[model samples]
Target chain A: MTRIKSDEPTGWFMIFPALAFVGTLILYPAVNSFTLSLHRIYMGLPALGEPFVGIDNYLHLLQDPVARQAFGVTFGFVILSTILEIILGLGIALVIHEHFKGRGWVRAAVLVPWAIPTVVASQMWRFIFNDQYGLANLVLFGDQVSLYVPWLAYPGYAFLAIVFADVWKTASFAGLLILAGLQVIPEDCYDAARIDGANAWQRFWHVTLPLLKPALLTALLFRTIDAFRVFDLVFVMTQGGPGDATQVIQFYGYKTLFTEGQVGYGTSISMAVFATIFILSLFYIRTVGSSLLKRETI
Target chain B: MRYTSKQAWLLGGILLSVMGSLFPFFWFVITSIKSQVRVEAIPPTWFPDWNFSFYQTVFTDHHFLRYIGNSLMVAGSTTVVALILGVPAAYALVRVRMAGKVWILGGLLTVSMFPQIVIVGPVWQMLSTMGGLNTHWGLVLPYVGLTLPLAIWILATFFKELPTELEEAARVDGCTTVQTMLKVMAPLAAPGIFTAAILTFIYAWNEFFLALLLLTDPVKQTLPVGIALFQGEFTMPWGEIAAASVLATLPLVVIVLVFQKGIVSGLSAGAVKS
Candidate 1:
């Protein structure tokens, strides 16, 4: 191996291209977005002047009921969706973890939802919940036409629909993560549990669940961040409609920025989203990620 | 084999997993091939006459092939560039001595978690200014930046696992640093690189938010964006949308079916490593 003296330059050179790509495209734009938040620039009205508003947008965000509701909606989505995803994901992991014929097919089957585009999933669910011709109605009521529920028309049902759709789309991904954790659990633990006269329930409760924490937490971290980034589902399914019921932070930001043309205000919303996720991730890494990393090293 | 209560429970779980996972997409597949009247029937026709009029419309009218071309170009270039930049960087991170290496890796992780909306506004402005918008490279450049973290992380883990003895043996044969990396080390990490490529490709393909903003031109819009904006005014065009959805998703479904082992391992690797 080369000594440190000669190796450093080559190392720096090797990493440069990747660094350049991330730096110029992602980091630079991220910083620029923050700066844009500080000024008042309306894309539709440039003559109004892109003035430096300093903290006015932030002040306005605090008072805006819609903004508050959007944050509330996003956080609610993150909590409810991740919880369901983890529980369902655990079941999927447990089911697929066992030896069975055609297990590869099972694995691929589970990945179908994840493989489908988010927009597609949104549309699929939207159609499924359609009042006139929906699978939900067809399955539940058979030929009863009047019994159909407009799933996306009600704010509460619409929100729940979005959550259900998210869980369906991502649980397999979480299961894959939890399955990795399950794989790392030594078979000896299960063997030992059985020797102690533990039943199936006991073994899973005492052994499997305990060891799956890191993977579960990792899934939680990833899912929470992603749920906060929920836009396409809301955009495609409901357009954040039925009275702003499904307006998650990202969709709201998109509408404000692109549709409403409030550049500074819209960017300010995006900045808040970034900051919230950043802080949440920092918290996650501090609490869960460090332990997971340590376990990986060991 | 004797049927038992436990086995029955396991069988139930398995059935639920399989059916729940496949049913939605399966329904879409069904819808795609059905006649319009059959699709909107109150009871919803369970069987398709295998009418592919929707598919034909999607392919001919919606510029489905063009969307495919655009998606293929963007996703393909992103995959290649992410790897080309990522592998060497990963190798260096694993093999070469550097200052602030941990910080650099941490920064990359943070970048991976960035919300597209946050960077999207400025990125749009930047691309608009640089005349990069409405071009294939416009999407590729940002995608490469975004996917590098996953590629680099996975490749680094693979490169790290390779025994230094192999590199030393190459060195003893009077191979230069570049030569050793290109020849001895890279071949061993092929599986890892392949895994990284699949993940990156899927991501670039499925990504909607960035593609929606960056490529507004109908000729240049990627499949996700195109399919999303396919909603019609008079009718929902559920059949056509279903057809487009199925067509857009068929390639990825094929990829998953063909490469489940690599994808599972690759995704699991992200969980454990990141």
Candidate 2:
């Protein structure tokens, strides 16, 4: 807690080993990806045979229709899912903000889906959404449920299925964040609102919402960033299949690298993801990061 | 305090939401034990036949024990390595004000963010060259990279929250930095360390894509990847798959339940703060 001179060396020597691990493992691969993106590939020694062909991959990515569609889906997925999670999270957080009986159990239960492995949840929901034997149609549509609606086998429905699972799993995450926000709100404000005869809705709008902004933004940014790079559930559930309808940029990048063996091409897609996310962080930094740092410190 | 009808309705809605959330796992357990005939039946059996046979089949044929062992090894190794490496880095970053903390954090976060597919190719190539492919180390090392940055950040936050006077006093007493860290700081921050360890373990244990790509040997694969092999491209072994899944997930479920507060706190730490 001591305030020292700003110029004083904090003796950060201890961090170098950890820093080195990240630099070598993560940054090197990321930089390698960027380098690969700029190079042309030929199958040869070291596997990623290359001569530098600057910006070709980027240009090709820009022009490729499939890549474009995947980009659209990625954007759609991030924006739509993040927005929905935030809204629902805020609503649910408000409902659970106060003290109640069995609150601890309810709180733990809400996190169960979040704790489950992404692949397991995907498989579970896959069967549930199965047109033939799945419970979704049965529960939602009664015995007259048709056995032909392939949830993962179709294009649009496949996308819907991915989004449904993502939202269902993560909205509670948003809720948890907002609940933390709610917990931090001083109770006196609510007491004051009641003394002023504010209705529940009015109190929420005037009191809770304003106080919850930082946490809301934190949850939104976290969800936004996470959603942008989503790969697991989609990969396991559909493998970007049914003619790549559910394919997002991440999966597309993955396919290019691993499945096609076009290292350079895959690297280009990967770099694009890195750059896009970096840009997002910058944008988030401009708006919410400061507030987050301030609030977290307090 | 008095209850209004509106408040009561809100409580009901919240309760219903929580119940709806838990309904899937309820179904998962019920279905896992159901007979394959019942599992595939049109109407869907609401309750399982109370048969231990599915559990028997899973443990007997599927190398279920090996998968659990692999999971424990990968997850356990990941937890240990990340803590050993991350705690010092976190201390240095927060206490020493490390020069590249931001870039390091950024890079680590990026790795965490990138889909496993993006790096799996190059990583596979690299590991194969090192003869790590199909080894537990292959998965464990990547799992460390996967969890390290977040663990460092979480611990850094805890470190920052810590009052530095004790460390200062230890230093003034001629205690070395390592000694101060071990003697004064580590014990005080046990909860934070536990939080990091548990979360890292869960993440590594639950990880599928990396395990799938690197560990191609059926006998060598971890539980998640092992479970995937049971359901081939041609055939769907419903009973066996469900049973394996139930077993694969039990450790995580148990850990989450036992350390619910720590896990939740860590997740909230990540989500609500950064």
Candidate 3:
């Protein structure tokens, strides 16, 4: 606010607490995780001793079929969930963006799921999909007791159950993001499209879509990054169960690190997770930075 | 006719979206209120019998109130610390001339994008080493760290948007920077700070991963961790778990309902900004 080239010491002083907290807790530990990844350490077998085993854990991660399956699952989960969220989110954004009575209430309604804790949402879905007396079964089979699907027990359905829960929870978030994007588009663009004899779908496809690209990309990137680190859903709903079908990478890391106490191997998985997100965020930053730079030049 | 059909389609979509968003939590709330027999009924009770027995049981038997208190303390402190740190950092990042400002923000962006798995291992170890495990401060320590990036981002955008006149006038009044900041800018930035605090509070309240790792003792665990682990202690504490979930999530739901606009703006601004 003060355009007056104020003293820089106060700037540093004001900023120290946040920097200190992040540095000590996040940046330092992140680096520590890297160093920890280099050594082979087991919590249960301390006598085996902490041995420096460079790249062995990485190699082990590569060979482990469970890790492979986890990645594959993570890949599927990200793709399916992000696609569904974007589609549903677009529908939501389009609907809410229109001038409607009680729009605030509707928007708030959309945010309810986003507001609930992931653990809570996961439990809610688990109950919803419960085989015995679950809402899913009751709604589907009614009094007929035989057809209750053990949704989380079956591998294919189990995966879908988590994805469905995810979509239910987060579609609203994407919707809000897209709505923010939608609010910025000039009304004249649509008016012009209508003047050119463009029908609703045609105008949406031609004009609305192209302009909404950045927003869609923003939503997509955020969703993708979040979906990559999905742990609470898998942990609560499925626990990567019924043949490890839902074992996303983060859950795998958790089990290995905390459950099994293989700290070194676990940290490698953590590194992989970090690397994947890092690369993704770099791509996002490039696109975002280029746009900002473009604005600067203009 | 075409216009009416379009409006109908819009209405249909709007109804579907709202129901889809609200139905799951609404179901949980209903379940939380259902009697034990009614909860287990095959044809699940469509309407609650207005039973809050499960709520009574959880608070009494499961010490659910402790978890809630723990969550409140952790989330509250996390919000305070995040804002205390974030507001000035954001102010500096926005207003003050600092070198390597771009890199600091770039680093903040990277931190925001970081998956918890990346930092969980060492954070766990560090907490364990410091005997911070199972302590509220232990959990708050990392919570503050993880939330700072988004807090700063949101606050920076808010600070950038404030009109310059008040700040300029304060400066011209010969008030020192700190005095002007504390007395002037902060009150003006209250709305932004509140938004940031709400977002941070909700995040810390709902954060399960670090809490799960750092706070293992039942007495020390926050609400999310408690709710997540609610099932293991009983054969099928569905009713109780539902009750706990409802209890755990009620504050957040209220937060969303009341400050929906602020939360949405903060989230989108943080996500979309530099």
Candidate 4:
């Protein structure tokens, strides 16, 4: 095979346009956010210029009760949603992997929630959870029941509603990825396992689980990061309401920056989010190693 | 071939899952057509009095059509821009065999994962300073950046699978690198381009946070932000909101149905890999 001569200049030239756009649009804003977090800039009318305040923003975050509550809400949301998505997604993936009539239609149906925008999905759920005219009360209680519980108006129920919505929207995404992984496994392995007198549970534990690790990790990683940074759904559904019951970090940052005009403080929250996501990604990559990036056969 | 208990269980589970996945959308469609009186009625009207008044209100009173135009313009532009920049970069990563390629790919993936909130503050400030706020281009610029990483990843996977002999043949036939890439390689990679375009357009269309922040002017808002902020002065208009939600989601549903195979492969490529 005749090797194309490795031309560094040509490679650099070809890559320049993408690098330039990414650098200006993504990298610069990221660096600017980091810099702004260290300053005291008020976005209020008659804008006060940024002044270097170094770590004060971080300290303020530590003392802010609302911020602390947001962190807790975010943690719970991420953990609960990710776990639920994994279990539900795995079951769906396993079922869809079977040879069934109308399987193609089922797969397409599953992608609908994921296909719809988060805002729309949240609105759909909000209507269902409405206190007065909501389907939840009408159906769960008698049709004539006057007593109603506004699900989104209370803290605990509001939080549960958000979790329920998140899981419903994303579990199919997890299922699709895991289904792709399931498709790649050789049928002969299962045949061989059955020949060796292995039961269904034993085969799944030994063969399926081991081979499915990469896909499982990939699904978990994407879902965790996404759940942590959730904004549009929560924003549209509750606006982190019921006295900051469901405020996640992203929503907190939005309020600080856009609503309160505290640029420095908002950037601090944003920076914290970035750091947390970076650490999580590093953990996944380190544990799963390079195989996460390997191209899987369809 | 008698049906066994296990097969029955599996079939039942599949049926339940399908219903669970699709019921929300069915409800959404039903809500869109309900009358205001019915929408607010207690013992929520299971069977709505067939009414299209909310749809009329959304189209005529709210200027919902303009929001759809804005969304289409932004998402369409973002898809085009991301592809133009991403294709060459993906080609280089695949065929150039550059050093530190793995790190470069990893860095791009990390950028895709950057929480939008982190970037929104700086991006807002930059656009404000440049007098780009409340404009279509302002939103399109950031969306291009956000969608580029995924586009490049998907395109790169496709490019990597292309045989090098095609490139070599084009080169030997007196084609420059640019000519070979544009004339020979791109045509062969059509399916990949289609996949990338669909996904990129969806992301831009569905994005809400930045749209809410930058396009505060009602006329400039996209569908997601527009429908979200459509709360009435005295009361929440569930009927109008539901009608508008259906309209906003219609384009995506159409896309999913028509291009299910491409969308599925594209999603798997971005998530799992090839």
Candidate 5:
């Protein structure tokens, strides 16, 4: 009763079509982005007529105020959102760790936000925050604070609004990943903690927290990286409005290339994004890559 | 060891967390049904008189139906293409370990991470040149490219985990490679395929940037683009937008609920464990 005789060459041919498809879509786009980032172009009537300008675009971009501010906002959003998500995510995962009825339903319901598209969620929340008819303003501030404050219209609140939406949509993602980590902990460690008279908090702190490190780190890595690339939500919510408050690095990069028709400059902005993500990913890979890899594979 | 005070605290934490999570959704649903004045009223109304006016308006006011149909077509087509292309690729990577496979996989991951803006320029030019702009195929082609790598990796990992004996037996019984894949392996890998389908559907459904860049015609717009067009200065009818968003999300929500297992497995499977 043997199965799948190892006829490897046929298998190779079968996968080649997919390889070519990805190459055109993914690989080429990535490389193309870098190439354009290095070139300078002139925005004309319709088509972009351009000449080459090597690192000039990047050098100018490095000193660009708009680009720098977007970078700052992006860093702030990613760091803040990742921290909140991990904390809240871990808290939720711990609670679900208990034996309870309707737990499955609860878990599924919590994931609803995570599953919804960012655009939909952002729009939903944007409407909710609408100063005139928004639920948030009506409920939280009311007409007393002047419902005309336009939550998305103000810079600070705009950034806050985007973060709020992101946190709502993604915290469950952190929870699920952390929950998977919780499942992997050996039952005996908790049993030992109980026998030692450790309180619930003590047991969690000394036992669960350490055990869940890999999952925590993994969630952090994914969420943080995603935060840096945050575009759709912000794009939909504010389009980096109210004087560039909500604008993140990605949005700025995109505008430079597409909206402004500065291909070279836009590419540089994107290159900066790539470089930013690359550095952050390196630190993550260096720190928890091995541990996360082991846990995931095994 | 036995259950103690810690268990009670744990339960309390769970309750609070659940409340935190479910409140916004509850709020959104309630708000969606409320009148504009009630929705905008101070201290907010927790409950609303049931009204379908917003839904009615959303349906009548914009090209909601067209947008939804576009979404379905694009998502459905992408799912079909991703499955056709990704399944075999995944199998090949798993079974053959073909040369440059690692590079191929790496390339896929990079694209998945590639911001939509970067490629939209060239892709738009390419699609327009091919006369695909604003058509369903333009969106579908990019989606297939976007999702195939992920689908392949996920399916390949699942395929790798299957017992090799079933396929070997089929081969010994004179089943050709395609026959073995179709008859023997496909059935066994149903769960993984479901995961891939659900995932592909989600990406296609939620996709915004490419849809925004490529599909410019309001009548031909996808759901995301259609909703975005509703955003305007002077007035953005909250009730209408909410209604449309709720409607747009209904299919996705239903899909997520019905395919909860597949959703989770798809997300986790696509990510790691290779």
Candidate 6:
């Protein structure tokens, strides 16, 4: 293979447009957000002119009960939704991998949920979970459904409803990634396992599971990070409902920043969320991403 | 031959999963066509009565068409901008021998993963200062930045895979770098371009958080936020909301079904590749 000796200045020039756009739009906001986080800008105050507080915003976040609850809620959400999505996604992937009739249609059907907007999905689910007219209460409770058990209005049920909605919307995404991974596994490996007198379960456990690890890990990393930073689903479904039951960190930060107009405190919350996601991304890249990349090259 | 128990189980599982996946959409469609009285009925109607007034109400009374127009404008402009900026950058990264290219690509990936809430405050402030708030361009500017990383990454992957001999042949034919990229590579990477465009457009269309924060005016709201925030003059209008939701999601659903292969590949490109 011949390596082309490209001019460095030309390369910079080619990349300048994208870099300039991203730098001005993304980098500027990120830097401004960080700077604002260090100040005491209340709602309705211009962020540029806010008084410098020097980490007090971060300290305040630690002491705030709502912020702490949001942390717990966000953690629970990330864990529950990721686990559910992975399990369901794996099952769907495995089933869809089989050479069955109408598999193409099924594959297309699966993408529907993933394709729709999160706000639309959440609203759809909200309608389903409505107390008086929702399908959930009608199907689950039947004739005994006399009293109004507002799903979005209740704390625990509201959280569960959000998780259900998230799992439904995103499991297809996980399935798609895992399905891609499944496609790469050579059929000969499974044939070899079968010739060795291994049962179906044994073949899947030994032959398939190891080969599917990188894909599963990739799917997990994406889903976990996404679930951790979830905003739209929770925002539209219940707006952190009933009394902060479904309030994740993103929703909390949004409320602080937009509704309450506490730009400084809100920016601190945003920073905290970013730091958590950054740490998780680093952890995944170190642990799972390396192996995935190594396997891809091999 | 009669079906085996294992085959039956597999069939059942597949059916169950598909039903689970499509049920919400089915129910949503059902709700859209139900009358207002039936929507709030005690038992909740299982089947629609073929009442199409909600659709009419949503489009006529609610001005949902304007929101759709706004979404198309924003998402379309975002797709165009992301591609124009992203394609060349991706080409440069893939073909050019540059120092710190890896770091640049990694920075793009990291930026892509930023929680939208983190940047909302600053973006809002910036837009407000520039008098861009509540305008289509305000939302489009940020959407372009937000979707560029993914476009660049996907396009870069495609560019890297193209045989270098093609570029060499183009060079031998007296084609400059820009001409070679435009004349030779762009046409060949049409699938990649389609995937990137579809993904970027869907993201911009479906994005709610930024639209909600940036465009507060009812006249300026996009479909997702507009439909979501659609509380009627009095109580919550389930019929109209359902109708609007259907209309809002229909375009994306149709696009996905038509381009399922590209959509799947585009989605799995990042994760499966690296």
Q: RMSD to native for every prediction?
A: 2.0, 3.0, 1.8, 2.5, 2.9, 2.1
Order of the predicted models by DockQ, top scorer first: 3, 6, 1, 4, 5, 2
Q: Assess every candidate by TM-score.
A: 0.96, 0.92, 0.96, 0.95, 0.92, 0.96
The C-alpha stretches of model 2 lying farther than 4 A from their native spots are: A3-10, A42-49, A145-148, A290-298, B97-118, B232-234, B270-274
Clashing pairs in 5: A2-B168, A2-B169, A3-B165, A3-B167, A3-B168, A3-B169, A4-B167, A4-B168, A37-A267
lDDT of 5 by residue, B163-269 (tens): 98777778779987878788988999999998898888888998887888788888778888888768534666666777787888787778767777666656655
lDDT per model, in order? 0.89, 0.76, 0.88, 0.87, 0.78, 0.88
Off by more than 4 A, model 3: A288-298, B232-234
Best by DockQ: 3
- Candidate 3 yields a Cα-based lDDT of 0.88
Worst 10-residue lDDT window for candidate 5 chain A reads: A42-51
Number of the predicted model whose lDDT against the real structure is largest: 1
* Candidate 2 global CA lDDT score: 0.76
Tens-digit lDDT track for model 6 on B1-274? 2348669878987887889999888898999998988898877768889999999998889998899999999999999999999998998888888799999999998998888887888888889999999999999999999999989988888887888888888888888778888999999999998899999999999998899989989889999888778787887898998899898888887897789888878887777776
DockQ for all candidate structures vs. native: 0.71, 0.49, 0.76, 0.68, 0.52, 0.72
Give residue A267's error in model 5 in angstroms: 1.9
Report the Cα interface RMSD of each model, rounded to 1 decimal. Answer: 1.9, 2.9, 1.4, 1.8, 2.7, 1.5
Model 6 chain B poorest 10 in a row by lDDT: B1-10
- Tell me the tens digit of each residue's lDDT in model 6 across A203-272: 8899888889888988998898889889988877888877989999999998898889888999999999
Which window of ten consecutive residues has the lowest lDDT sum in model 3 chain B?
A: B227-236
